[model samples]
Target: MTLPDPGKSYAQKRDALEHYFDRTAADAWRALTSDEKVSKIRATVRAGRDDMRAAILATLGDDLSGAQLLDAGCGTGALAVAAAERGAAVTAIDVSPTMIEIARERTAMAVPAGATAGPGEIAFSAGDMSAAPDGPFTHVVAMDSLIHYELPDIIEALSAWAPRVTGSIVFTIAPGTPMLMAMHAVGGLFPRGDRAPAIAPVPPARLLKAIAATPALKDFTPGRTLRVSRGFYKSQLMELVKR
Candidate 1:
């Protein structure tokens, strides 16, 4: 797959994603913040995502206090809100307006009353990470979202944010192994398949090359590889530091 141009403005890319999510925006929101039964169903559908986020945070080490984080493509604000709970100031952005709205609502509901707050805050926005706002963040994350675009686009998007990071970037993508390719083929053949978008893993080498192409990025290291049931594909996580 070829990556989209990095030159496109964040707003433009966001508009495209918003258009796609418009059809199911309301349903997505409802599922995210639904009652116990509905939320459980949603969780089952997104089980892999929950696992991936947990793994990413684990790779980041235990000390997350007072860190500023940028969560790109923060669907329903899962990772963003979790980070805030851990005492990190988080700015979560997504291309889908509905997703952002749902995430904001969830964030509000999750915060405890009369709790001593730190520098942590969960802020949601409708923006694209491909061209995110400038930041000097402690950590930048894009989980299960970069696979939508090709390698070049992923590189450009992550690179733009990498330079502004004083700490590290933790990202996850579906690998393009034989199993993953076969799964994608099946999904294409049968749209009703349980697998969802960005779930089919891409090749780790491709991701590494993308990072290498960006002179501003280095220390590309592979993290854990986890098999997610939804996509039936093994997801690879990686961490990179700006050189």
Candidate 2:
């Protein structure tokens, strides 16, 4: 609920996401993040996401000792835990309280029962990621978070954090390919209760253009970018680092 005043469109998208993740989709989301057997499409999504997480973490370099990170929209805390295990203090935030609860359980199980010193500590919070506290963060990763928002909202979200981040801002967007755009259209035709939030496809070229035009983000320039396409999941990862 820690939402800074967002524009109407952003607020609407945020509220829908909160409701869907917190209530309608909690169990299904948990299953997706776990090792449980799932449909072929869901399995592909899981694989794509796994690969995306590794690629994103790799971009931050192998060792994260003494680093501070923000895992915005950190569903299930997989990436957050991995970063912490590498010795980074991580702040993991998600809109779903259910997701935060699962993240806590997973984190406890990750470190040994009575270790002298655990890997860098993780502080979990259930709130709007746009409201994440200002930090001189070494890194910030927002995997699969902004796909549902329009370009302007995406820009706003990035702008809000760019000033606070000292390292990189890495995030994923649904590629504006015909297949995905058609999928988005078909998804919207489903019963309102049965649909996930609509992912607004964004072309990589357009995103780069927007970044260049944004003044608050003038200090940042494109870094490593990757596209992970495994079955149904088609997300493009983009990284921004200070000039």
Candidate 3:
């Protein structure tokens, strides 16, 4: 079995994720995000994700009129659809072409009857989080997408994106607990086929310290936080806002 490669760069991890989600686990992911029945473990995961989504959206409050938002790493576009319903123009993107197509279909079915469609519309595409349109973006929401990268890489990404965002950037991370570290180790022993990319569990203090030291994020500050821990589903939801 291949051991954990600490030297794996961000691009390599991203390519792995693109392959896993777009090809290997595409069907499993689609099922998990749907209302259809799932296993007990995936059910907990779905619930935890739902809680995180609500927490992130709540931080922005309701009535997002005139907001230019980027739903970076949008999966099936659930949050994107919700934001659009609240009158925000959302640029929703993800690395998986299959997920993008699913998001587009979901959005098409989500149109409310006789509603004004121009201002709050959603543009869905297949690309990385960095593919976000030229901004002054009022808001950027990156849900569970960043959980696969190391703290340093995460810091670099936040630094690059912070200057362009006028309002806030919200995202999630897997906490670096001993149990998760064990899980990471055990994941390495699995056969190469049909295995998900390793999850990078990060400690909060370490992450926060790095964020504080990043030059580009100097103009921003950490905001409200929510931690959701359910069976087989653990995540830390965090917000970063302009100071």
Highest TM-score scorer:
3
Q: For this target, which candidate reaches the highest lDDT against the unseen true structure?
A: 2
| Every candidate's lDDT | 0.63, 0.81, 0.78
TM-score of every model versus the real structure: 0.75, 0.89, 0.89
**Residue 123, candidate 3: C-alpha displacement in angstroms:** 0.7
Ranking 2 against 3 by lDDT, winner: 2
Off by over 4 Å in 3: 1-4, 109-118, 181-193
lDDT of 3 by residue, 1-243 (tens): 132354588888777788877877788778888898877667877898888888888998899999988888999889999888888877777999898877777766333422323457877777778656667788989888988888887887787678779999998888857576555444332223545567788988889998988888898888988899876678898899898
Q: Give per-residue CA lDDT, model 2, range 202-230, as digits (tens).
A: 88899899989999999998999999998
Write out the backbone clash pairs for model 3: none
Using TM-score, rank the candidates from best to worst.
3, 2, 1
Lowest lDDT block of 10, candidate 1: 189-198
Error of 1 at 179 (Å): 5.8
Clashes of each: 7, 0, 0
